[model samples]
Target: MSKSKQELLGYQSHLIQDNLTYFKPTRTSTTVTFAEEIRSSLQEPKKSISPKFFYDENGSKLFDEICTLPEYYPYNSETEILQSIEKKLLPYLSNEFHLVELGSGSSVKTRLLIDVLFKSQKHLQYFPIDISEILDQSAKSLCMDYENLKVTGVVDTYEKGLDFIEHYDDKPNLITFLGSSFGNLDHNEGMKFLQRINTLMKSDDLFLIGLDLKKDHEVLHNAYNDSQKTTAKFNLNVLKRINEELGADFNLENFEHHAVYDEQKGRIEMYLRSLSEQSITIPKSDLSITLSKDELIHTENSHKFSISQIESYLKESNFEKLEMWFDSRKYFALVLGKKI
Candidate 1:
């Protein structure tokens, strides 16, 4: 049901053994890469590490917690859209196509789409790409529950998994990039990723993307910085990761997590700020870094989009918007796109 460490540059699978295929990159990065990234990110000007690092086992659990919090709206809003728009999205799917999911964590929301597809087609092939291996009986459970469904799990980055599917398989696909995961990337990086999807997929191939829509500043801020501090624990868990893996001296109690809504950038920025001046030594990277009082290490930027902005992204990424659905409150958007 759950596998940890599926974040970018995080998975280390060597091979896929069975029909429950996992995406193991042809080349593997050394363990030192983690330390290298930490060292580089903590350098002078901009102290930062990717939000992807927040998906390690513990971080993933914390995120699961954040998703269920009352203040968080994206999960519930996107689920509402998927529930309402399934029939509309179904007409585009072909009987022989593969339903590919990028960053398919838990595959919980995926059932809505698959249910609709099964009504028309007897059998279906699914490629649920994530950075984590299936921990529970996901493959067994899905196959048993859906008699005609077969799943191939990919434990790799989105790019690597998409490349594998494009090169090795020719099945027309209805790819779902749910969860607004793309928003974690900077605007340019997001476009580049979309551009890759445009290139690998055919003109008729379907693309579904879920994005958090720009809303009240307080709402966005509360979503990331909940009253219960679940998100705070989630953000600081990254430091716990470094302490455990890199032999780094990071006192969790000395740092506090906070989030801010960046109005101009249309993003929610999460950071871990040092409470006081302190030095941390990471033996793996052979690096020692000192923090000033209240110094912040930027952890993530979750960008929200307006409808107009979404249209611009769709056009620039070579996708034509086919159908768009939003929650009753218009807090989230799920758009079905056609590759142009």
Candidate 2:
């Protein structure tokens, strides 16, 4: 059977009700308006919004497009590492494993891992946790073809720290944190994030992490600031979202997308800059904000890592590195660790 048909056959009856709760937040305009009010008020000096907020339905679609662009090396590089190292990674898995994925957007890169795991083990249960509700349908529909796979999705942010941990019975888990999404958090935040995952797992459970390695500034800069301009549109879409849902009068034309490599911070910073001094009104909050020409509203940050840096992080989080794989250019890495 084809993947789609298989998905239909394996579709769980309970998932329909589950997805209702997932889609509830994004359907109402009130949530969007409130989010805008919170965003505008939070924009103090040197302020920034978390990229996790950028995964609304539209933002999620835009991001999927961004991954396909030539300039975005992280997606392709990580996919390569997963595909090439799948055979070796499969041996580490014992029987009847539960596969839990963090930030499992569309499970695009995960298909490679799933294929390998199926070959090694007879039955598998898959849990994909992501903040975007739209991904639940996409992930469930895609994984339908695998007979042994049962997919339960969580639509909460990773910062919630394992809100859905009780969904699975006490079974050995092979958890995956893919796409270098871990890079979104700073060093201290990353350590805490890993420690949280460590606390949830049994001593024998395995964890796989994908990390984008530190590369040339030019290359990293181009990846975020692509020539195709899709990333720019993706950045500005936040404003479009605010305007549509919050009854805000934001002139998308007045703002330009800006992304730069901050050498001192060692991260890629994304901002939306006003072309001229302007005042914008948000109807929901009954507030107006003034902006100076070239003034920026920070949106996102992508931090790069080195192998040694990642290893040190794992140690601090009480995870012992079992194995690691890297691409030829060493621009990306996949590290497998277990609770120490």
Top model by lDDT, which number?
1
List model 1 lDDT by residue over 1-340, tens digit each: 1234333334334333334445465456443477888998998577997787788888887888888899999998988887787677767777777788887654568787788778778988888877665443555667677877877766666777776666545567888898978889898999999998888786667888889899999888788878999999999999999999999999999999989998998898889999999999999878899999999999999999999999999999989898888999999998888887
Candidate 2 Cα deviation (angstroms), residue 46: 2.7
Best by TM-score: 1
TM-score of 1: 0.91
Candidate 1 residue-pair clash tally: 3
Which parts of model 1 are misplaced by more than 4 Å? Answer: 1-19, 28-32, 133-137
How would you encode candidate 2's per-residue C-alpha lDDT over 178-296 as one tens digit per residue?
A: 88788888878888889988887777789989898889998998998899899999999888877887788889999999999887777888999889999887776566678889998
Q: Candidate 1: lDDT of 262?
A: 86
